[model samples]
Structure formats: C-alpha cells, structure tokens
Target: MRITLERSNLLKSLNHVHRVVERRNTIPILSNVLLRAEGASLAMKATDLDLEITEATPAMVEQAGATTVPAHLLYEIVRKLPDGAEVLLATTPDGATMTVASGRSKFSLQCLSEADFPDLTAGNFTHSFKLKASALKMLIDRTQFAISTEETRYYLNGIFLHTIESAGALKLRAVATDGHRLARADVEAPSGSEGMPGIIIPRKTVGELQKLVDNPELIVTVEVSDAKIRLTIGEIVMTSKLIDGTFPDYQRVIPQANDKEMRVDCQSFAQAVDRVSTISSERGRAVKLALNEGHLTLTVNNPDSGSATEEVAVGYDNDPMEIGFNAKYLLDITAQLSGDDAIFLLADAGSPTLVRDTAGDDALYVLMPMRV
Candidate 1:
C-alpha cells in the first residue's frame, strides 16, 4: 500500500484512535493500529478488545491495500514532523515492514497482516437517539468522579444510564457511586430514547467520550443495545462493550427527607476546607463542620501534626449541629458544582447529607458522614 496525506490531518485522526491501544499486549496485533487505503481516503482503527475507535481522512492513494503498525510509534513519528508537511506511507511487497517518510526524516515500522486484527462485531442496535453534545457532557462531568475504582465490585466501575419518568416528563439520568459518595444528573429524554435498557458504561469509555464531546453545537448520534454502545461524532466512530453486571439500586441511597438546610457561598466554603485540611496527612481525613444560626466553622485535627480552623458565614436557621465528612470527597463534589451558592440538607450527624446546586442544573449529591 502506498498513500500520501497531509501530516496534520493524519496526526489528528491518529490522536483520536491510537489511545485505544494498550502499551502491553499478549497478542501482537492488539498493540497496533490498522490502516486501510481505499478509493479516496485512508481509514485508521485501533482497539483494546473492550473498546474500538475508527476515523477516516482524505489521502492520495497510489495503491489500495491494508496493514497494521504499532499505534504509538506511528503517532509519535507524525507528531514530531514539520507542521503542514506531506507524509508518505508505503508497505513492502513482502508485507514485512512499512516505511514512513515526511520531509527529510524517514522511519520503518514492522507490519502485521491486516487479517490478524480483531474486529469488535457490533451487533444490531435496539435503540437509537440524537442528543446535543453539551447535554451529554454535563451528565458525564457531574457523575464521573463518583465512579468506583475497586475491581472487586465491577458493577460500580461505570455510570448507570437509563430513562425514567420524573416531574411529569421523561428524563434520562446518569448515576455513579463508590459507597462513600453518589452523583446523579438528569436531562430531558430525546424522542427515540424512551424505554431504553439501562447500561453500565465503563470508566475508560466514559473518559474518551468526554474528550470527543467538546463541541457544544454538534448533535451526537448514539446507538445502544443490551451489550454494547456506539457513538458517532463527525468522522469518528467509537464502539465499546458494556459491563455484564447489574448496577445496584442507586435511588435508595439518595436522601429524601433531610429538613435542615444551609446555604453558603460555594467558593468560600471550598477554600476554607482546603485551607484546614492541609494540616492532615491522610487524603481521607475527616473535616468537621460546626453549624450555628448564621455562621459555619470548619476544623481539622491531626495528632501527628496540628489543628487548623476556618470560618465562613452561611444562611442557616436550624438548631446547631456538627457533621464530619472526608476532606477529599468534599472537594470532589464541590468541583462539580456550577453555582455560586451550595445548599446542604442534613438530617442528623450519622445520616447521609444531600447537596444541591443553586444554578438549577438538575443534579444531586449524597455524601456519607465520617466519624470524627
């Protein structure tokens, strides 16, 4: 195969697909990206068994053929070439190696037969929908931080996506939890998204999808079945296998009757927590919040080090109370808030606390308290 394409165009497509390839692989083909030169374009594909991404770019093809080359190596070579340079890719007649030439630099990469590359056969999709990129990004950004990293509980390793009737409207929701904290966000359900099966999207796929939805104006096409999901954005297509486990009932964990409420400036409260938590050495150290009529005090104490305290004014009318929470968890939840003020609903010192955004983002948070 012999093809010539603009370096910038090739590099952009490579950047999108090459991230699916893992550095270490038991099968050699799994470490490489497949390149197919056809009529007027070159197709680039990479996969890691669980996830696959493909993209096509216009190229001048002298010969139509296909081959596989190391994904990272090819990406690095094209990245260092001169901007706007023309790149030439040619494979030997014996199909053993491929030569890459750009400007005055040239390199050869070992090739694998295209036949050896595994294809993630995406079966027929049961449901299809179109959603604005901005809405999709909001769902991921609000819940991704709560996804559990524990491998033993595979069900909590991704976000739970489904449609439900809420407030007299059909809404699509994303929920994620790690036992200590939970995040839930909702958006209006699209016309074709009703009665869709709930799917658990793995963490790696969620991260990649978040990167591709930066263009807010674009309408993303999403296709889903019981076992897989496919997303198409412009010339790029991403297919991923869903987790085969059942997600727990996250709605049961959401607090519903917390009557005491306190409203504080989100920025000031987060800054105070950060300042006081600096005295502790552990990441999950508990920070105590002491609430009064119109003021709040944050305190952190570490026996090995010292103690720190910061005060902030809040709008509270309930009786005085104290609650403890993980300092890191507090920061993670605060970072996701899109409002100037944060509202906290508390039932007791031992029960879970509910948090809401003043910006009316249709997102809610549940945080378990820690013993001080």
Candidate 2:
C-alpha cells in the first residue's frame, strides 16, 4: 500500500485511534492500528476489545492495500514532523515493513497482517437519533462527576442514560451517583429515541464521547442497541459495549420535601469550600456548612491540622441549620453551576441536600450530609 496524506489530517485521525489502543496488550495485533487505503481516502481503526474507534481521512492513494502499524509510534512520528509536511506511507513488496517518509526524514516499522486484527461487530441498533453537540455535552458534564468508581457496585460506575416524560414533554436524562452524591441533568429528547431502552454507558466511553462533542456546532448521530452503542461525528466513529446492569431508580433518591432554601454566589461558595478544605484531614476532608438568616459559614476542623473558617453572605431566610459534607463533593457540584447563584434545598441536618442553579432548572444535585 502506498498513500500520501497531509500531516495535519493524518495526525488528527491518528490521535483519535491511538487513544483507543491500550499501551500494554496481551495480543500484539491489539497494539497496532489497522490502516486501509482505498478510493480517495485512508481509514484507520483501533480497538481494545471493549471499545473501538475508526477514522477516515482524505489522502492521495497511489495503491490500494491494507496493513497494521504501531498506533502510538506512528502518531508520534507524524506529530513531530514539520508543519504542513506531506507524509508518505508505503509497504514493502514482501509486506514485512512499512516505510514512513516526510521531507528529509524517513523511518521503517514492522507490519502486521490486517487479518490478524479483531473485528468489532456491532449488533442491530433499535434506535437512531441525533443530538446537538452542546446538549450532549451538557448532559455529560453535569452528571459524570458523580459517577461511582467502585467496581463492586458496577451499575453506578457509568452515567445512566435514558428517556422520561416530564411535564407532558419527553426529555432525555443522564443520572449518576456513588451513594454519597447524585447528579441529574436533562435535555429535550431527540426524535426517534422515544422507544430507546435505558443503557449504562461505561465511563471510558463517556470520556471518549466528550472529546467528540467539544465543538458545539456539530450534530452527533447516536445509535443504540441493548448491548452496544455507536456515536458518529463527521468521519470518526466510536463504538463501545454497554455495561450490563440495571441502574437504580434515581428519582427516589432526590429529595422532594426539602423546605429550607439558601442562595449564594456560586463562585464565592466554591472559593470558600476550597479555602476551608485546606485544613481538612485527608481521610474525610469534611466541612461543615452553617446557614442562618443571611450568612453561610464554612468551617473545617482536623485533629492534626489547624482549623479553617470562612463566612459568605447569602440569601437564606430559614432557621439556623448545620450540615457536614465532603469538601471535594461540594466543590464538584458547585463547579457545574455556571450561573451566579447556587440554590440549596435542605431538609435537615441528617437528610440529603439538593442543589440547583438559579439560572437553569434542567440540572440538580443531591449530596448526602456527613457527620461533623
């Protein structure tokens, strides 16, 4: 196979697939990227059994053939090449080595038979839909921070993606929790997803999906089946196996009767949490929030370290209430609120507290209080 591709285009496609290739693999073929040059473009594929990514880019193809090369090594060579340099990839007649040449630099890499690469066969998809990139990004950003990392509760290890009817309109929702905290966010349901089954998108897939939705203007095509999901953006396609587990009913976890309310500047509250948490011990890192009529106090006390306390003005008209929480959890939920004011709905000192952004009603967070 022989092909000439622009350095930028090749690098972009390589960047997408190399990330899907695991650094250490038991099978040698799994560490290499399968490249196919045909028609007017070249297609590259990388997979780790659980997830696969394929990208195609326009190239000047002198001959049509297929081969496998080291994914990361090729990416590194292309990345270090001179700007706007055209990269040439050609395989030897015996197909034992692939030669890469650009400008005055050249390198040869051992080749693997493309037939040795594992096939990522996608099952039949029952649902197909299109979501605006911005909406998809919002759905992921708001809930992924709360996803559980505990392998024992594998159901909570990924974002729970499903559809629900709310106020006479169908909405797509993403929910995640780790027993201590929960995050829920919603967006208008895309057409054709009304019959979609709820699925648990694994954490690795979510991270890769985030990279594809960075551009707000792009519309992502989503295809979902009971066992797999495929997301296509332009010339790149990412496919992953869905986690086989049932997500707990998240609505029951959200507090509904919390009456006490406090509204504070989002940035100020985050800063106070960051400052006071410095004195918190590493084990718990707990911070106590005391709320009164018009003031909120954040305090951290550790047996080994010194104490820290900070006061911020807020719009709280409720009676005095004190609750403890993990400082890092509070900061993560607060960071999701881009609005000026963050609203907190409190039930009491023991129950969960609800948090929302005054600027948007589509997202909410529930944080379980800890003992001070």
For all candidates in order, the CA lDDT equals 0.95, 0.94
Instruction: Give the poorly placed runs of model 1, Cα more than 4 Å off.
Output: none
Estimated TM-score per prediction? Answer: 0.99, 0.99
lDDT of 2 by residue, 1-372 (tens): 999999999999999889988899889999999999999999999999999999999999999999999999999999999999999999999889999999999999999999899988998999999999999999999999999999999989999999999889999999999999999999999999997999999998898888888899999999999999999988899999999999998889898899999999999899999999998888988999999899999999998878999999999998898999999999999999979999999999999999999878899999999999
Q: Relative to the unseen true structure, what is the C-alpha lDDT of residue 357 in candidate 2, on a scale of 0 to 100?
A: 91
Best by lDDT: 1
- What is the alpha-carbon RMSD of candidate 1 to the true structure? 0.8
Candidate 2 residue-wise lDDT at 323? 96
Q: Tell me the tens digit of each residue's lDDT in model 1 across 37-107.
A: 99999999999999999999999999999999999999999999999999999999999999999889999
